[model samples]
Target: MGQDAIAPPNGITHIVWDWNGTLLDDNHANLAALNQVCAEFGRAPVELEYWRAVFRRPLLACYEELFGRPLADEEWARLNQTYDRHYSSLLPSCRLADGALQVLTSWTGRGRTQSLLSMAAHRHLEPLITERGLTRHFTRVDGRRHDGAHDSKAEHLVQHLEAQGISPSTVALIGDIDDDARAAREAGAHAVLVATGLMSRARLEATGHPVADSAAEAVAMLGD
Candidate 1:
């Protein structure tokens, strides 16, 4: 396995969902912003198919791959500043995909607990959630910050578990990338990989993790 493989433990009551690609369907916007940034520096931009394979990591790693060169710390910061400026303007055009809100609402209606665990910085994620009117659906929302690092979803997941006074055995991580599954496994939580984001079914299944077609299916799988 690429990472540790694990099964769900008993009493999985909470769900932590990945934000951008999984819940928000912002991959198209993200790819556009990244390519736009790359073009400014005369770097070849990544295609949709190619980006899916390596889009889960931190922004700097994704930028380095596009430019075919590692950026200095300051250079990376400048690029992020630029990207954030462009992306913020584009946020108004973004929205949740099919079945995303339904799944979330279903859980909320049933009084099931949920939270957001994402690699996106809190500034961006918070407004998006508010704009989409999803803030009321979740008990907690955990995200990266502008001044702090959350290079991986795994780091945020650990912090969320501690802050929520919950254990991995009582929670599940729902996301669209291998990193999501890997993070859940490492944290001893159940992972429900969804196909609605960047990764395909083949890639998710290859990791030996359970996969769902959409958020609705993921929610159904957790049913009574």
Candidate 2:
């Protein structure tokens, strides 16, 4: 579907938003962190286009792909730690995506129930949302807990909807990665991939979901 065609024939009432690349314009911070990790591992820094092309969920897979080999348990842990440190240091300089606030405010005015569903740790996610002054826009905000190895958002989406007493059929997920689409599909909800975030438009289109060029356009797709 085209960017303008996100509205499903069946109506939509709730929205599940991705954090890092969807509403927040933090792809630069993500790439910078990854590049720092690469440098520490003696690998070349990757270009933005390449990062967008190869980014994936179960993030370890993406790191392994870039590193050209599987990571040992401790190595993976170290890499994760390093990336987190770098990203945290860089996050203060990152800003929300263009039109993010406007779209969020508009949706709130329309009484659309929205929630943030991210793989980022809850400790980190909650503070960032508050720091960005976006906490009021969402009915609920969730992030990965510290208890286990959180990888995919699919199962989390199921729990999120269940907790909200919302049927999957009434929700649409907007994100910047293929994993987001996969999660939405697994949960039986519609998915809208935004191109101006983590992934390239070509890569997002390959997921066979409607792609929006901006947050405003993505919001526009859910017409009145």
Candidate 3:
């Protein structure tokens, strides 16, 4: 990842949002779900704070971090299945992040463009957003179509913009992890990292992007 800080937000034509921890306030569900699977692996349950600190992209790293051992290929698949099962069971109770709707509605009302790009499986991602009546807010919503952990959102962000026929330089991505900032930079896009998702505020800030307290603040910081 690059060490340079993000450029100031200006000339942004569209906003790209992250799913999971960014827009969806699913930390409780995520923690509980992982813990559910953790128990099956003979690991102890993790609290929200601990989960925030350790969670990372390439999810296998997170699994290895928690389990304290290298995972075999088959074990990785089993862990993913178990985690997905528990996470799916918890989906119904998950809620959107605070001010998430207002940010989306205000942007839509202003007639600006926005979309969703995520590491979440598309099958789960699209339905969950639709379930909350949020499908109308975005120009496009994309998630992983295959089964496996993601290493970065860079390539996906490029493809997401390409599908929308939007230029990367004119877009700003609002997401909650270091990977988000890194991805934006890699994809030639701007970024505003929000602290409402999985990663801690300190960790988000460490990426050298503009870090916001919440989604609303992220947009405001972007001069919304």
- Model number with the top lDDT: 3
Query: lDDT per residue, candidate 3, 176-209, as tens digits?
Result: 9988988898889999998887899888877888
**Alpha-carbon runs more than 4 Å astray in model 3:** 1-7, 147-150
State the C-alpha lDDT per candidate: 0.77, 0.85, 0.86
Show the lowest summed lDDT stretch of 10 residues, model 1. Answer: 1-10
Candidate 1: C-alpha RMSD after superposition:
2.5
Model 1 C-alpha lDDT per residue in residues 97-120, reported as the tens digit of each score: 778888888787776789998877
At residue 110, candidate 1 shows an lDDT of: 77
Candidate 1 lDDT at 184 equals: 85
lDDT of 1 at 76: 83
**RMSD of model 2, in Å?**
2.6
Worst 10 residues of 2 by lDDT: 1-10
